[model samples]
Target chain A: MKNVQRIWTQGVALFGLSIIVGIAYNTTRIVSVPWIAQPIQLVNEMDRILKPVYEPSIKNISIDIAKQLVDKNIPFIDARDDEYYHEGHIPHAHSSGDLIKLTEYLDIAVGLFNPFVVYCSDDDCGSSEELAYQLQSEGFMNIYVFKGGWKEWNASGLPIEITSNE
Target chain B: MNKYIQLGIRLIVGGLFIYASIDKIVDPSEFAKQINNYHIIPFGLENAIALILPWLELFTGIGLIMGIYLEGSTIWIFLLLISFIALMGQAILRGYNIECGCGLKEGQMIGLAKIFENVIMLIALYWVIIQPKKYFIIFPKTELEE
Candidate 1:
């Protein structure tokens, strides 16, 4: 019983010591992380500087809006992995799995000013929002995140294309 | 022979911990994303975990190697190993093919292999706990004398 108590005390002491050192050291770092995670804000503050008119660059769209965008022939970006993307995705959607490859294709095929939609596996998946944020950072002005992504699209009986491995 | 073997295990485990903490401490944002991939920790607490965990690993590793707080360090490492095993096991079972977030190796995906590796380390930690002889300890002279 005494040994258990002693061990617990010592373990806690070490933990407390670590917290002190960790927070102190993080303060000294040039790129220190916030102690608490800030919520994901789709609005990029840089937009104010880049576009004085200041509309949100990234917008969360419903399946209806996403469908409308598809009908209009706007480009779509799949934020899921290559395997998942290859399995089945919205027709004409580009894969954002490899940012470099995606950006390269975007450079030649699409303009930064044109609107694009990003989506992932499902509503619960965060990759769509994450990709939207990445696009926003990359100075893509008009971005839409289809929160109800592939799952919703497929469930709705929307048009999809499966890429062959050949 | 037994004494030298135990000392060697101590140093190896300690060294491993120190090595693991470095990359995590450097790129905490990436580490936070890795932790979030597990889908276990909620309320954005992965950020705090990412911040503190590497430091704990570093201190635990240093304590083990220096023999500064042998019992505490071993206990901490044991607890950490168990949590890691549990987290990895759940991630594998759920079919979330994500990065391991181990900080030891980059881009190492979570799988049975990682669990096996951790299990081996857990066994080593257990060995250190049961061993009667402790050598070259710099602090808490009483334990060193024993």
Candidate 2:
């Protein structure tokens, strides 16, 4: 038991020393990049590991609001892959999830005045949130994520586009 | 067994840890994301763990290899391995099919295989912990001669 306690105490001391050294080592990097110039600044949850700054929060929208937006004829963006997009998508929603496709669709996206309601395959799918953050970084304001995405919409028997891939 | 066998285990374990900390120390953001996938910590302390854990591994690995701090370091090694076994076990039970985030960058999914890998490492570390004679250490004459 004494040896065990000694080991534990030593481990704690070693860990604390490592943290101090690690922070100093990482901070005194060869090149110091400005936080604002970074593609995305770390904030909130990312602050724990990331330095310089924490990531800004992204706005999330619920399915009900997403449905209302759909009814209002606001442009919808599908944040899923080409295969998934072609499988089935929300009616009238444009596919701009992948980088290549989004670049191709950028002309239309930049010209649009209404906010983009982006969604992925399902609730657990992070693509929608990720795409929203990407758009925000690109100076596109008022992006909303349909947290309950294609899965919820399809299950609810709402408007959907089934493009046969097979 | 041979004292050389213990030396071999020490080197292997220490080298493995040093090898493991490299990728994590480089890309902690991605590592934090991987930890969050485990769905264990609620407060998003994964980042804190990510920032600090690799350095701990580095020092412990070095200590093991050099045999400067044999008992405490090996104890830490075993403790870390046990925790890894538990983490992998929990991930398997919870059905997390995400990348194992093992040293090789998503080497495999967390499953029985990953758990078994850590188990084997734990066995090796335990051997280091209780070895009657550590062969290659330079400091702490009392620990070495005893």
Candidate 3:
């Protein structure tokens, strides 16, 4: 009984301490931070994880559509960072990865009417969706996020381009 | 058997949690989305869990390693393991293939592999909790409160 009581006491104390500290810390970051992705944005993330149908401008496409796009020489944007792109990327995917400069990149890479696919390192990385959203918000239509991303591309042994020498 | 084995277990488990906490601490929004994918917790609480869980994991880990509140930390860690197994198991059953949000590793861990991983961790924690004796404990024994 005493051991149980002691554990309860410590547990309550520790839990309370954590709540107080966490709220105090996170509240400041959530309110003031421009770059920090805030918690409010997470509420609908799962719902949007699958193909988003609500927005006519943006959609999710399968590996095959991405392949067709590649074969047709349609535009493709690599959502991953510069390092990943330089290492190796889809044969001709362009880097428009910087969040701040994405719209500028879209202007340089393709016309507003051109349909293209965005992909990152893998499905788990949200950068592709982030890029697609950025494209949609910037008034471009026909953006498809290749959720399987580069992992699937490389795994399938598709043609790859390496900007850096081995 | 050497009592130091328990200390080693404490350090290993605690170290694991601390390591897991770092990425989640830096990227709670992604972690929260990972939790939301399970569809187990209500939507409103996801943000709260995202904000607090890393700190709880970190403190519980520290408490275990330092033996500051051994009984409490072990109980909490055990409870965590159970919830992890339950959540991952349900996600598998429901067929939502998503990341485990373990925060230590890159890439998505889905399906049976994730459940099996949680089960392994649960077994390890059970061993820590059911030790016959403890050595180098930092907390005062209840009897000493007299």
Candidate 4:
């Protein structure tokens, strides 16, 4: 019957459309940049929205920080887990990850108002910078992140203080 | 029965598909992750599924809205609905916690409620398809008295 033929044609058409739509949508994403993942940025201006939040800046410190630390006896904190800190960490550094508890450890290690530097696993890890931000939020005026973190320190053969808090 | 209602439903459903596809087309990575999380498709097919499906939605949607190919577009919409339902049902049965990816963005959980909603909509569409007499479209059956 004519109706049966029409049904068959419609079914075939629908099947074809499904395939076409599926392919087109996927291709659009493959060509897009990573910025697409951050949808919130689209709704608000990045700088204005992010400025008040704790962030790291270039002037946080330079290489001479080591001499400064030795001279002023500045405190160093490791942001990785206890295992990484035990395996190796900056000499005289303590391990801390939760930003809320940085001050407790700081109090035990170097007392309030002492300059502090925090470092984490690697460049890809944002934990160090995040911890630094939390410190700033808590009114710890002189906080910095050793951006190179543990990987950079170990890779460059820097002197490490070994501890066995195991 | 009036003929306008059937045409109106088709246009509304088709337009919805086109509008929905736009956001996904703009960002496929988010949608791709959603598709993978459903666990209905293998990881390898995620990219392919993400690539071109939106265009099909847009095209079919527009075609239906325009009333240029009502019969063809209705069929396409039905098939799409069935596949979506199947995919959702399978995912639920398998106990996958995932965003359906039917709507915009990733990490938005779509559960059995959405699947059920689609089923009802598909049924309505099927009713319209079978008996278009209650609706109106640009094209109507007529004769010159041949």
Q: Kindly list the per-residue Cα lDDT of model 3 for residues A97-141, writing each as its tens digit.
A: 455576676666665655667888776565576557556767776
Best by DockQ: 1
Q: Which stretches of candidate 4 lie over 4 Å from their true place?
A: A1-166, B104-107, B132-146
Ranking by lDDT: 1, 3, 2, 4
Top candidate, metric lDDT: 1
Per-candidate TM-score against the hidden true structure: 0.81, 0.64, 0.60, 0.49
Ranking by TM-score: 1, 2, 3, 4
List DockQ for all candidates: 0.55, 0.29, 0.16, 0.13
Model 2: per-residue Cα lDDT over B1-146, one tens digit each: 56777878888888988888899888776566566556565555766777778888888888888876666678877888898888778867753445566665443557787788789989877766666666776544444433
Tens-place lDDT per residue, model 3, B1-146, is: 54666778788888888898888878776677667656666535766788888888888889889877777888888898788888878766654435688877865566687668767777877886776666666775534221
Write candidate 1's Cα lDDT for A1-166 as tens digits.
Answer: 7667767877998899889988987899898888777644443233332232224466667787778778877789998878888999999898886677777776566557666788888766656765675666676776777877899999999999999745
Query: Alpha carbon lDDT of residue A9, candidate 4?
Result: 71
Comparing 2 and 4 by lDDT, which wins?
Answer: 2
Point to the candidate with the largest TM-score: 1
Every candidate's lDDT: 0.79, 0.68, 0.72, 0.61
Query: What is the C-alpha lDDT profile of model 4 across B1-146, one tens digit per residue?
Result: 23566666776788778887887777665556566555445435665566556666776687677654556667777888999899888866754444577864433445788788789869978987777243333432312101
Q: TM-score of A-chain in each prediction?
A: 0.67, 0.63, 0.61, 0.56
